[model samples]
Target: MDFGVAAEDEAFRVEARGWLGEHVGAVTERRAWERALGAGGWIGLGWGEGGYGNRTASLTQQVVWAEEYARAGAPPRCGHIGEKLLAPTLVAHGTAEQKARFLPPIAAGDELWCQGYSEPGAGSDLAGVRTRAVREGASYRITGQKIWTSLAHEADWCFVLARSEAGTRRHQGLSFLLVPMDQPGRIEVRPIRQMTGTSDFNEVFFDGAYARVEHVVGGEGNGWRVAMSLLGFERGVSTLAQQTGFAQELARVVRTARETGAVRDPVVRDGLVRLWAELRVMRWNALRTLGSTGDAGAPSVAKLLWGGWHQRLGELAVRVRGAAGGVGPVAWSASAPYEMDADQHLFLFSRADTIYGGSDEVQRTIIAERVLGLPLEPKGDMG
Candidate 1:
């Protein structure tokens, strides 16, 4: 892979860098930050303009934008679920009407979306989704619960995978529906506080919430395919930005080590060097897989590579900090949860890096069964 940026990509990198530097800290509210990004035509850089609010750019240009955004320490995107995941799915599988109706708001960052794929009973086993969406006239009345739903409290919409037909099991009779979140007394979102003292994840309940029939993507009873397609989209350009963030965190850890003279230890120094080298390899791997749409295991492979690497970084972060990283704030009977520093928080929250999104076991299974053409794992009879 070419390491040098092309001239055109260099120009885009400069523009994106300049714009992010000027405006990153201006709109602290993510909703307003999203509007600002939309106004700058920064949202949906890969989609068409018929959405009226989307922008089109080359893949390299999108990569440039992502790297620059991370370098600028830009705010985490609050509109990503809509623009990155949903919009692409809409373009691919949605009806013309669905594209026209949903794409515009997402491009403009006017709508926020959350994924409702996992449930208490169905995390990696998505085919086991039990949320029900029964059709009622021109709409479907959805009734069920979703767990580990990121950005649920802040989202205006949720794309849910639910069982639409009764007496059907596993992947059969499922439907994907885009349901609104403004229904009073019909839907509820309860935030799930994490060990990092953040509530970006939530548990959402849908009690007969209405979703228009036209909102079903790729037709009814075919949600498994669409959901899987969206998962493929997961390994898109933002990975560059994620790597940049990891670099920054690693830099912080190195700085901490140097401050306390830990870097002088040969063992500590060796671990740091290994992490740096592994990250470079990970970056190269990511670049090699860009635009590899036909590879069934690309997304899972990418996830496997980064998940363990990140967890190790977290472990090393706390280790570099020695005992201090292990300490947390006092817990006085009714006091708030512990507020952690950068290293401590990274150490704690990153424990989920291998677990969420898709667990290491799940990714390996995908690589084995899909990529390696191995026999399907045996499932004992449920009856």
Candidate 2:
């Protein structure tokens, strides 16, 4: 692939860079920042593929936006689950009314969404979901628990996968339902404190939570297909932004090594150079696989490459810091008694990099069976 940007895409990069440099520093509030992006037409960069009516950027332009967004040092997006994942799915499989009703608020940044897919028992094996939704007159009542739900405490709505029909097993009889989170007694969110001393991930409970029948996407019993489609969307332009963030983190680690004289050590120097080169490979791989949705294993390959790469980067972050990495810096007294420094936080948090989303083993299994035509691994009891 030619790495050079087209003339038009270069223009878009300049525009995005200028806007982000001006506004990203000024907006610190999460929801307000989302609104500013929405008003500035920065959200929903790829709705046109599904024919949703928005100013659609080409795939390369999407890459430009994500790269610029990351390079601008903007805060982590609080509304990405809605804007990137759900909006595309709705356009692909939702009813006209569903699209018309939900897409506007998402683009406007008026609503926030969380995913309710991973359960305590069904995280990596998503088809093992046990959450059930019982249909009533005009609505379905959801009852079960979802663990490791990011942004659950702040979300206004959640798209859940639940067993909606009796006698269903594995991926069968499941429905994708969008349930609101404002029902006081029916829903509860408990935070999951990470080793990094933050609670951005949550455990969410649904006790007879209601969702309108119209809110179900891809119809009842077709949730597996819809959910898989959402997974495909995970490899969109956002991966470019992710790589950009990785570049920034690696830069910090390189600076740390230089400042502390760690670069003088042969091992440390080798690690730093390798990380820098591998990041470029990842960027190229991401660019190569951007629009190749026909390749079932591309996403898994991408996942496997970056997941372990990030974990190694985390290790290097601490290695360069030496014994000093063990000490936690007082970065946030309000949230926890002690806070981890940048290196400490990176080391601790990225331990989960290979575990969440799709575990390393799971991604490899996808590549083995789907890409290489290898025999599938035999199923075993979870017990």
Clashing pairs in 1: none
Cα lDDT tens digits for candidate 1, 271-297: 899999999998998888888778888
RMSD of candidates 1 onward, in order: 2.2, 2.3
Lowest lDDT 10-mer window, candidate 1?
A: 324-333
lDDT of 1: 0.86
- Per-residue lDDT value at 229 in model 1: 82
lDDT per residue, candidate 2, 297-374, as tens digits? 889988888888998898888887783344333234676655567877887788898999989999999899999999
Provide TM-scores for the models: 0.95, 0.95
Q: Give the range where candidate 2 is weakest over 10 consecutive residues by summed lDDT.
A: 323-332
**lDDT by candidate, in order shown:** 0.86, 0.88
Candidate 1 stretches greater than 4 Å from native = 48-53, 323-337, 380-383
Instruction: Give the per-residue Cα lDDT of candidate 2 at 367.
Output: 92
Separately for all candidates shown, the number of backbone clashes (residues 3 or more apart, or on different chains) is: 0, 0
